[model samples]
Target: MIKTRVVVGVDGSAGSAAAVRWAAEEARMRQAELRVLIARHRRESFALDARQADADADTSTVQTAVQQARAVAPGVSVRGVALPGYAVPVLVHAAEEAALVVLGSHGGRSFFGQAHGSVCSQVATQAQCCVVVVRGGEVPADGPIVVGVNDDPDASTIIGRAFEEAAMRGAPLIAVTVRDGGSSTAEEALGTEIDLQLDPWREKYPQVRATREVIGGKPDKVLLQQCRQAQLVVAGARQQGALLGPVGTRLLQRAECPVLIARA
Candidate 1:
């Protein structure tokens, strides 16, 4: 039976392994199935390459990733599928029915090098649902969940997703607002507006402990500092241009914990 699952991309990279672990844990917490996906491009097709040895190897890689995910979350329902297509389109289609999509910060890269923009970024940007980029960090059992909000309409979507995530993990939610440069009066006013915007979430998720902070600084830097103690950091993506917002891209590169980008 087809079920809603936390879909994760696995390509035998260290980063992909880390993503598998995080996705498995998240699936367990959310009481959802875990689906591990690996995409093989047309050029990598088994019939065309090395008389099926390459296909066998690719299949083994997917199965090994499935095993690792199962090890991470024992008893959680996990399945692996190997698809024939490019990474971006394959993963984006997989997200159609997924509760959320999780990807590693970098995939199939030897060194932990530049990943400011990669397949993960593209998939996250194009996916219809939420996308999580799992980076290096030990998510503490009791760490708070951090979310960055703005004055844009997309902030509502971001904050709502953050509340749901915090409730699922039973962790406190920290709502951070970064202003470029505002006077104390303007800051106070913006803080009040933000609080008003959070009312719906508060009522919907009364069990979640929510706190708000507004300060003048660069959004990316401020959120990175908050990530120092957070289990997860969430940011909003514009509905129009770009798959990921500027701030979300930065956090994916530098966050100590996993970063979730909620599409508006």
Candidate 2:
């Protein structure tokens, strides 16, 4: 049987290092192979000497990241590749056959930058499979897996991923639905809607301890607040647009935990 693959991009930055560690743990949990990739741009001049130097440096960076992954997850199969291209397209192409594509929130001058924020946004929006942006600080080994839910069609997919994550980590699942109204009636109605949505997932993962929360606030704000205590925050990717929806975008930009955008 072919093993599922988890692909991650690194650029020798702290953020990418965090992504490598997080992706390593994720691959270990899922029993998947980890593929670490680095993208490099060749100068138009194409000096053979310069080209060889760039290849050697890029190879070394990927190798360091591979060593980090092996150190973090010894039992998982891991490899590294240094490819020539821009970061966005190379990683997106890698995502075509991957179960997940992991990236850091920041990058170095070579591969990623704050500008790569756009790169992360683009890849998360365009990748064929799920995309995880490792943000904030160290990933918590213990905390509830949090998911944002609504009446949207993608909510089920988002919640399902959350339960799978929680089960894999042996963590509880907190399903949150946010509303702008403070009215008790509105809260109750939204609560019922959330319960109905979570029902099937609850039955599907009986081993996962799950809870429903109806919070009154902006979706992104409420979810950001929850991120403070979450191991991972799962959100839905808007299928029709070039961007993830507002909540997903904000979480990608500012969430206190790694954000997983479910692509369906």
Candidate 3:
């Protein structure tokens, strides 16, 4: 059987280092190995020696990140690799064996535009396992864990992961369901469905305080506000050719906390 591991991407940036730290803590919490991956894209304009020099630099960067992660989570399994490929493809492929993939948010021009970096957006959307994009300022250690739930078939999977995280953190879990342009009847129905769906999860995690909120509005707007007081925000993602599901994309773009996208 394949061993479960938490994978993180490093680019020698402060943001990437932060991702390593966050991922290391997560791996330690889950008793999983932490794998740090760094990608060096081929640059045609550079001479052979220059390209080799860049590759060597990336190797050093990966080693430094591994050291940092080890420091943050002592006794946790830490490993690093320097791969030859573009960032998005390499990271997404690595997700195949990863229990979770973590990466930092850095701005760059892409098809998704400037609000989010292309690699972060693409990997989060395409990865088979859960993808976490670390964004926003300092997160409160005492903040609740918020999760978005809708009528989508994958709501149960998303809720399950949220409950696990909340239980591990010893924090409460807030489940938000939105009814857009709907009447009270619709809201009531959704609330009932959400409650029924979360029943088993609540039982499994009896110690985890689970709260449900059924509101009338756009999901993106509601979750964005909820993110302000949340340590992490969880959302479901549907495969859209080259983009994430609409709600997931919006949450990643504007959430005030790290967003976890569970791809379906």
Candidate 4:
């Protein structure tokens, strides 16, 4: 049987539910098993009131989330997971066997945003597998999947994965090139320069209906606007062992829909 293993962390948020649904569809396309994990901290770590509450309540919460995924793809195998401690370590551990991890961005997903739902931020930077961030429920349709390419060769995974996702979702691929508009001279030639980089990707993923759009402006703003109603927005993790900076620190946090941070 084909196996395209995928995992997602749910915290009972609307965004997390969107991520779970997105991953379920992805697993269905890949004919893979879907694992839904919810980090359950030890009761002792919480205040006495919550600590004394029924542990089964937590288990039921996790099971409910798993059911959410199973509802989307009944044929795919589903597992409900609850671990002790913060979401990062628990999710990174799940990534040991997962091909991709899906997450949701809420409140403040940016570097300076509220830290309430930033678990995806930590996992994206450290997970062994790819991490997908979804901010809204809309999936790209009849439109190109936008990818923010960077200088890192590790970005190949993002490119390759975007093709697969676009093909599966029947969305056109739009390879976008954004240069620092901080200076006029750099801005003038950035569009043409990005087209050169998009050429090889077009050839490699030819089967995946795609085109290139070279936009001049800030990377974060351009990407956010492109992802407004997009099926998916993908970017490569920074080469420095962290998925920070524009994509990680900002874009992934603010994009309206799902954003995949594949290894670069």
Q: Which candidate is the best by lDDT?
A: 2
lDDT of 1 by residue, 114-224 (tens): 242477678777898889998955767799999987766677888999999999989999999888897899999989988998889999999999999997788889999
Clashing pairs in 3: none
Candidate 1 off by > 4 Å: 1-3, 44-51, 107-116, 239-242
Query: lDDT by residue for model 3 over 1-264, one digit each (tens)?
Result: 554799998887777887888999999998999999988667699899999898888889999999999999998999999998778888889998989999877555421122336677788877889999888368989899999887676778889999988999999999998776777888788888889989999999999999999977777799899999999999876633325677788777777788998753
lDDT of 4 by residue, 25-48 (tens): 888988888888777556465676
lDDT of each: 0.82, 0.87, 0.84, 0.73
Models sorted by lDDT, best on top = 2, 3, 1, 4
- Where is the poorest 10-residue window by lDDT in model 4? 108-117
Q: In candidate 2, how many clashes are counted?
A: 0
Error of 2 at 184 (Å): 0.7
lDDT of 2 by residue, 79-153 (tens): 999888889899999999899999988533437333777888889988989999999486567889999888777
Q: What is the TM-score of each candidate against the true structure?
A: 0.90, 0.94, 0.91, 0.84
- Candidate 3 accuracy as TM-score: 0.91
Error at 84, model 1, angstroms: 1.4
Off by over 4 Å in 2: 1-3, 107-114, 239-242
Backbone clashes in model 1, listed as residue pairs: 125-243
